[model samples]
Target: MVMQTINKIISANEKINDVLMNQSGLLDVVVYENASYDLNLLQAGQSLKVKVSLLGQNACCTLRTVYLSGTDADNKIEFEVIHAVEQTNSKQEIKGVAAGFGKADFYGVIRMPHGSQKCEGSQSHKALLLSDNACIKCTPELEIYADDVKCAHGSSIGTLDETYLFYLMSRGIDETTARQMLIKAFLLSDMPQAFETEIDKWMEANE
Candidate 1:
């Protein structure tokens, strides 16, 4: 397994994108005040473990993943984060779209280890199913071992919202355009602007 350690001081309102693929490794990140992380995963297999330590107050972290697989592909992601100090914040939003007969799984854990007071953490995982034979699993776990901390997690698996699709189509948008818009919103809404063009090309090629 490979291990990487990153330590940085992010100025206010700065955003960074960390993208990884096809490896088994451990990542350690320290986030500072008002800074954010856009963590993206593509075509990942084997094992990927990430641990973020929020060191400064009001530091924010966001995680988003997209997995496109074929019939024999097996992809998995494991993520963990800790609010190391007081008043830090983190959010994990993982969006996965699965097609063919492949399997995709995401496991996330957030912890506020002792003395990390007033920290807030939240995680949500949503999967889009495009084939009857495809399988997608999302497991979000939280361990709060501190006082005055708030944390929550959620998981859901479903196709696109047909009601919203119909609503957009009724407003003169074609079906294809409406679908693409919905997908882009779901997967790219919180991504950093620097990565938008690359993600757009990826989405078009995969589509």
Candidate 2:
């Protein structure tokens, strides 16, 4: 069990990306000021835990996860974020697609401790099932111990939308192409542009 720790002071209006791939360990990160942080997780297995802290005014943090599982594969990810100061914001989004007998689980928690006023936090988890025996579970929790703060969380699991698929097919797009496009859109919607090439390679290999 390896532990990675990162501590940094972000200047105003700065943005950074922290990317992890195929790792089974613990990660800790902290950021300050009007900066933005993007935490991306791809193809993780075994178990992973991420702890993030946002400090200073008008800071923002985003956590995005994309996972693909096949038969007998078990993947799990856990994330915790703390808005330790006022006027901070945080978000978590998770997308997964499972096939065969694969199983995936995601647990995310956002905390606004006492005295951390005027903060905003949100989390969303969505998964697609590609086979009858595939399973995915998501749990999002929010703890707001301060006043004048806003928080929300949601989870959803389903297959692709047939109506959207049909609409794409009606426009001269092949079914396979439409499905691939939709899957890519779902998994990469919240990702940064710098990750486009890597995500494209992953999609091509999986396809």
Alpha-carbon lDDT of model 1: 0.73
lDDT tens readout by residue for model 1, 1-207: 554454545566678877765445566677877778767766533456677878777777877666554466556777888887788888887766766676787889998988889989999887777568878888788888897988989888898799999999999999877876887677666654444564465446544
Residue-level lDDT for 37 in candidate 2: 87
- Candidate 1 residue-pair clash tally: 0
Most accurate candidate by TM-score: 2
Q: lDDT of each structure?
A: 0.73, 0.80
Displacement of residue 151 (Cα, Å) in model 1 is: 1.0
**Residue 163 error for model 2, in Å?**
2.6
Write out the backbone clash pairs for model 1.
none
